[model samples]
Each structure stands twice: as structure tokens, then as C-alpha cells.
Target: MRAQRGLILLLLLLAVFCSTAVSLKCYHCLDPVVSSCNMNSTCSPTQDTCLYAVSGMQVYQQCWKRSDCHTEVIMNLLEVAKVKFRCCQFNLCNKSEGSLGKTALLGTTVLVAILNLCFLSHL
Candidate 1:
């Protein structure tokens, strides 16, 4: 009986963990300066990279894939080399709040609390 209960609890935790682990995220900004701080948001799965680009005085932060990154755009007649990009795979690896990771943790914590309350009520 105890083992069965443990298994159920394990399953619950697993469900929580699985529910929120796969989303991609990155920072977004336009016309930002050095003091500018961008916020991260969920990105499409096809976006395999986080891009930070600077042209003249403008800044753009975006989520992108290598293919997208390679097929570069020459904005403002700037040379392709003048535009820069940085890509990463980890969640919120850019200069934004890593909310996806935090959200997953919060979801698991809430699930644990709800389960605890349910068990206690049964007692």
C-alpha cells in the first residue's frame, strides 16, 4: 500500500515536470540603448537561437534559428558583417528573465501543495 502511494506521488510529480519543460524562450527589443533591458517570452520551437543585433544606433533582440540567422537581412544598407547575432539553446540564455524555468518550478511547487492538501484532507 505504501509503495503504491509512493508510485502515485511520483507520477504526479512527473506530470508536473513534463508539462512545462520543452518551451523555448528569448529576449525581444527594438530601438534599445545600453541601459535598455529586454524581457524574455516563449519562442517558437523552430527558433533554435537567440539573436542580438546592433546596427548603427539601433538594437534588436530576437529568437532565431541558424538557418534564419544565416539568411541575414541587410537593414539600413549596413553590411552583413556589421550586424551581429548570438544564439543559444538553453532557456532564456539571453538578457531576459528566465521565466520558463521559474514557471516550471512554480508549477511543480503548486502541484505538490495541492497534493499535500488533498492527502491531509483525506486524513
Candidate 2:
């Protein structure tokens, strides 16, 4: 029946849409300046987090996983103060470029959802 065909089509669409191709990116900088972002990393799928570290006068930004970014550690180094590590979930949130680009992520999500729906309707 047509209904059966539709169901089969729906399943095929789901299979294609469900496959995730996530790529995480993070910016690196010694200070919080967008232009000063000297590095960037394309994190593996497991590393679903981003970390920003600051200590005394040094700052670093990179991608990390949930368990990788532990709480801050206060240590003494001669006359230097302890380092502080901050974690954020948003894409490029820890970047010196700021979080204004977050809206782009929303668009991507919506596109995926729309693709899924389109597949279902055709089925």
C-alpha cells in the first residue's frame, strides 16, 4: 500500500539524517583579542567542549571534552598566581572573536531538522 511505501521512505530518510558529522572548532589567543587568535583546532567528535585558561598574564583557548576540562587549580609559582580554567559549551564561545557567531549554529540545526521533515513527508 502507499502507506507502507511511505513508512519505508521515512525510515530511509531517518537513517541518512541521523548520521552526525559534527566538527568542533576553538580559537587560541594569549589575550582576549579577536585578531590575536593565533590558533584554531578542529576537535574530534569526542571533544564536545571548549576551554579558556587564564593565569597571571597568560591566556589560552582550545577545544576539550566534558571530562577533560576540570575545575581550576590554584598553584603558586615563585611570584605568580594560580591559573584559572573556564569551560563553555557554545561553538567558539571561548574565542576572542566573541559569541556573536552563535546564530550560525542555529541555522545549521534548523536545516538538519528541515531535511528530516522533508524526507518524512516524501515517504
Candidate 3:
């Protein structure tokens, strides 16, 4: 009986962590900056990924389609001579915020697991 309860709690916690609250989001910047960009925008449903690019002193980050995540496509679209690019598919996953979201999620997951274990202990 306790094992069943523990398994149920674990499944519930997994569902909570796996669900998406909203559409994808990406940091939005098209200017020269020395570090991470602070601005962001929620992506349209069609925009399935976040794009991050750096060219010389300038940085670019925005919503992008996963199909168009190639260097040549992004370069042509952004009109850059040479640029480095990264693409990802999660909230602010262009990493403008530097994994704070992941850290928060990890912390929340740990807290929930602890509480669930405590609750199960009494059952």
C-alpha cells in the first residue's frame, strides 16, 4: 500500500514538471550588448524554438522556427556577414537568463519530492 502511494506521488510530480504553462518564449534583442539580454517575448505557436546569435559586437535573440535553425538561413534573415547561432525549445532557452529557470525548477521539484515523501510517511 505504501509503495503504491509513493508511486502515485512520483507520477504526479513528474506530470507537474512535464507540463507547459504557455507557448514558448525567447529573449528578444537585436542590439549590441556585452552580456545576456534582459528582454523577452512569448513566441507564436508556429515559432517552436528560440534563436541566439552573436556577430562581432552585436547579439540577436528571438523566436524562431525549428526548421529554420540553420546558420545560412539565420544569416540570410538577419543579414549578417558571419554569426554564431544556437537554437533551443523551452521557455527563455536561448539562455538570456542563464539557467535560472532550470535552477528554480530543480528547487521546486526537490521541495515537492520532500513534501510528498513526508506526506507518504504519515499514510
Candidate 4:
């Protein structure tokens, strides 16, 4: 029974480590221009844009007037050097928040794993 518990704990720790490892953001992937605007500002393609060192990493976005007064914008995660463009759009405010939650969860899992590993080793 003790051995089984140890194995389960080890597996959990491994999972946590993997989650945290992948959660690290790639700085090169950051959108430089668009990142500067105030979160609540009325942004447009002209006002909100991102430039990246990687040739095609720029993202263009804008928030227009609507019934809900919400933001609407298109994102293009592109690699001009590789000739690739990943495009997406968001009108909902919770989009980025959800990703942030995932990152936090992964980080927490990793922290738990490390703590568990340390505790088990001591035992």
C-alpha cells in the first residue's frame, strides 16, 4: 500500500512538472505594438498594432462601436520567415482571461508536485 501511494505521488509530481515547463511564454511571440495600449481604450487597426522581430509576427486589432460597446479585433500570429499566419478574432472579454487561468493552474500544479516530492523524500 505504501509503494502504491508513492507511485501515485510520483506520477502526480511528473505531471505537475510538465505542465509548468510548457507554461513558460515565448518572449519572441509577444506582440510589441498592441501590448502597449490601455486595456479599456478604444483601439483600432491604426491605434492598436503589434510589431515583432520575427518577420510576420505583427498583430492588428481594433475595437469598434457596437450595441454592447465591446471590442472587436483580428489577431494574426504570423511568421513571415516561415510564411505562416495564424489569424483569430475576439469580441468576448473573457478570452485572454481563460488562458491566464490555465497558466496559473499549470503553475500551481507544478508547485504542488515539487512540494509533494520534497515531503515524500523526507518521509
Candidate 5:
């Protein structure tokens, strides 16, 4: 009976560790300065990307871009965020943010792994 109790405790700890380990937040950024344009124009745009881990062993990533507006003439910039886990193959989840022409861009990606356990059926 003692050995069984110890085994149950170890399994519970392992489950908690795995659940927390897979949940994380990641961010990335990029900035490029532009020249030779109107002073009123916005320049040097920067892009930010974020990746979030969700329930059901799933992952989601998103990105957003904005102008720095220090000078003029908007420029292009690129940034990327990546997440990997042992439950999934290499580069299981990732996100990229970049500027296109004179506009900013955003993107998102998601990955999930289903767990098949009924330990918390009451909850």
C-alpha cells in the first residue's frame, strides 16, 4: 500500500510538471529605420509577435506591427517567434510578424495534444 501511494504521488507530480512546462509566453520584435521621406510621415516600423500556450496541450501564436514614427518613410521589418515541445515534433508551434509595403501585419498559429485521463471527472 505504501509503494502504491508513492507511485500515485510521483505520477501526480509528473503530470503537474508536464502541464506547466508546456504552458509559456514568448515574444519577439523587429525594427528598421527608413529615410528620405516627409517629416510628417511615420518611419521605422516595429513588429511584435507573441505565442501563448493554452489548455488541452494546445499552443497559439499571434503578431502585431506598428510604426516607430521617429522620422519619416516607413520601412520593412521582420520578426518571428517559435515554440517546441517533446509531445510534438520539432518546431511544433511558431509565429511570424513582418511589414508589407506600407502596412503592418499580424499572424497566429496553434498546436494541440489531447490528454485521455478521467482522474478529475468530478471537476
Candidate 6:
């Protein structure tokens, strides 16, 4: 009965972890003189996406909403006639370069390892 309760508790914890909505993390910068922005920030709950935009020589990297990724909307926001931009949903994805996909993968691996240990201990 105790083992069953432990399993139930573990499952509940996993469920809560998966269901929790974590705020988006993004790189925040506007009109940076350098080619890269080193500043990082946590986005608000309503901001579900990371935005990277370029207008002429100016660069912008910040949090945004998934619904507002339109070209006209960005143009109006930046007050530029011509602009190029991309929106992503991952943390720090607004950088000028390099892949940061390992964070989630590493977390999942650690969680799986911990769960395996818990199960093995019961057996």
C-alpha cells in the first residue's frame, strides 16, 4: 500500500510539472549597435513567443505573442517600411545564432533518470 501511494504521488507530481504553464524566456533588445544581444528576460504570461526582427541595420529581439507575428503588424510596431522578422516559442531563440535545443532534452533526460531510480528502488 505504501509503494502504491508513492507511485501515485510520483505520478501526480509528474502531471503537475507537465501541466504547469511556465512563462516564456526571450532575448530582449532593440536597436542594438552590436550584432548580438546578450540580455535575456522572462516574458509575461500573455507573451507566448520570442521575436527576432530586423529593419535595415537595426535589430530587435524580444518577447512577443504568437498571434502578433504578422508582417504588417511588425512593420507598424517598428515603424519601418521594410522589415524581416521571425517568431519562435522556445527560450532564448531570438539570438543571432547557435542552437540551444539541448536545455529541454537535458531536463527530460534527468527526469527520466530520476523516475527510473524511483521505480528500481521499489523493485
Best by lDDT: 6
RMSD for all candidates, in order, please: 7.8, 5.9, 4.8, 13.3, 16.6, 4.3
| Runs off by more than 4 Å, candidate 4 | 1-95
Q: How accurate is candidate 6 locally (lDDT)?
A: 0.79
In candidate 6, residue 14 scores what lDDT? 77
| Steric overlap count per candidate | 0, 1, 0, 2, 0, 0
Q: TM-scores, in order shown? A: 0.48, 0.48, 0.64, 0.27, 0.23, 0.64
Candidate 1 lDDT over 23-115, as tens digits, reads 667677665465455577777767666666666566666776656655255343335456654555545555533344575577579868977
- Residue 68 of model 2 has an lDDT of 57
Q: Please report, in order, the local distance difference test score of every candidate based on alpha carbons.
A: 0.60, 0.61, 0.78, 0.38, 0.27, 0.79
Alpha-carbon lDDT of model 3: 0.78
Q: How would the candidate models be sorted by lDDT, starting from the highest?
A: 6, 3, 2, 1, 4, 5
TM for candidate 5 is 0.23
Total clashes in model 1, counting residue pairs 3 or more apart in sequence or in different chains: 0
Q: Which lDDT value does model 6 have at 97?
A: 44
Q: Residues 1-123, candidate 6, lDDT per residue (tens digit)?
A: 769866886898777654443667899988658866788999888888899888888888999988989999999877889988888876677777444456556767987997887777576
lDDT at 82, model 1? 68
Clashes of 4: 2
lDDT of 3 by residue, 1-123 (tens): 777777787788667645532477788988784575778998887888889888888888899999998989988999988988888776777764466578558867988887878586657
| CA displacement after TM-score superposition, residue 76 of candidate 4 (Å) | 25
